[model samples]
Target: MKFDELDGKMRSFETHHDRAVMPEMYVVARIDGRGFTRLTKEKHDFEKPFDERFHDYMLTTVQHLMNCGFNIVYGYTQSDEISLLFHLNENAFSRKERKWNSILAGEASAKFSLLLGDLASFDCRLCEFPNSGLVTDYFRWRNEDAHRNALSAHCYWLLRKQGNSATEATQRINRFNTADKNELLFSNGINYNDLPAWQKRGSGIYWKDEEINGFNPVTQQTVNTIRKKLYINKNLPFSEEYSKLINNIIEISGR
Candidate 1:
């Protein structure tokens, strides 16, 4: 089939004097796992900062979200929390936020439940942010906090594993001065192995999953598999559907 036949327009670029449609302000969706901390504490030996089995479980969770169509612009694993950023193209998706977010969350939870069986648990929700400086700052703030929390947890986990009590471990970090903590966390967020055992066993952004059992690129097959579910490769891709949905919802809600 010709590209234009499927898209209903010239798929090739055409430079024109037309002013580019200003994208309806970008939407930022943040999804997090629920019950992960308790699950982590229960399943892994906290004394050991790197637990292979536990890390594999944590990464499988991340894999599910990315597959479901969300772009994980960022991630942090400290205290068993994963934070991700999804920028839905307003130009290509209408009701973009609700449709994608809902689909991603549902696909993730369902697939995760299947992948880990009973070894782990998860719940997810979307938190929208104003496309403003302050809102942008809020993401930076929370992500940074997540970074701090993760480092503290890992540092303490290591210390405790080596025989220090929880109180002593906490005090040790409070007193340990390091000039490169931020850089360390930021780097690790982009590269998973830098993280503890649970995170390392898991994959990072742009990696494919094999054991999950759902996708075949050559067959042009797709599954509701959590790992790659968010990719916007639909024949229609729901860009127009999003516009109609957003307009209708706003009209009713009067927000």
Candidate 2:
């Protein structure tokens, strides 16, 4: 067979089942650290539950993704996971799920590994929403998940600190309801409500406009120009309020 004919056959085998997201659907690429429980605990020994250094690493990764050749409008990270919401019409790699899955995960894993000075990996998946309402609901769901995970993690570590084995800690936390977990933390002088907002709601990275004075050689005068920059928002709202915020972003995003 000729080379062109051989290449066509190989390409067909690989792409026969390929699927791309619809251009009109809101595209969210959620990247999660693979085997991160052991990676964070046994290897790095980062501060249990939340570590500011690790938190900053995730933030920087999210910020990088915002500028990495995509029309991403929002970046959210929590508990070793990052969620990137792109403009509804993003056309990168023709919206191929395989491209987004591999490259997004590859970028995240590379950035984190560089920061940690070790091999860290991420796996990516997409969340598709047909409308703004679903987008809001998706974010709200993740935010609530952050709150739940935070509560469980803090309680688990506290038990370990009191000499409970890992298995025992997990079992103990599993037995408690939300109120019981709050009370447990309160009894230990840790108020869940007073915890860092990022721990409960995760962190958000988005674009913002800033004005800078620039010298225009042609005009021989200084002029102010607006530039887009990535900003990290550690204090994200939750529930209905958070949904409203998501809607507002979509409204202004014009899609």
TM-scores for every predicted model: 0.47, 0.96
lDDT of each candidate versus the true structure: 0.46, 0.90
Leading candidate by TM-score: 2
Tens-digit lDDT string for candidate 1 (1-255): 787675655433332322322354434444556676565467534435545555445456666665555444433232344545444333333434445555656665666566556444444455554454433454445544544555565666666766989898778788765434434334445332245432322222332233355777888886655443222211111234423433332333222
Question: Which 10-residue window of candidate 2 scores lowest in summed lDDT?
Answer: 246-255
Give the per-residue lDDT digits (tens) of candidate 2, residues 1-255: 999999999999999989999879998898999999899999997998899899999998898878778889888999899998898888999999999899899889998999999999999999898888888888888999999999999999999999999999999888999999999999999999999999999998877789999999998999999998887889998888888888877876773
Off by over 4 Å in 2: none
Measured over all alpha carbons after superposition, the RMSD of each candidate to the real structure, in angstroms, is 16.6, 1.2
How many clashes in each structure?
18, 0
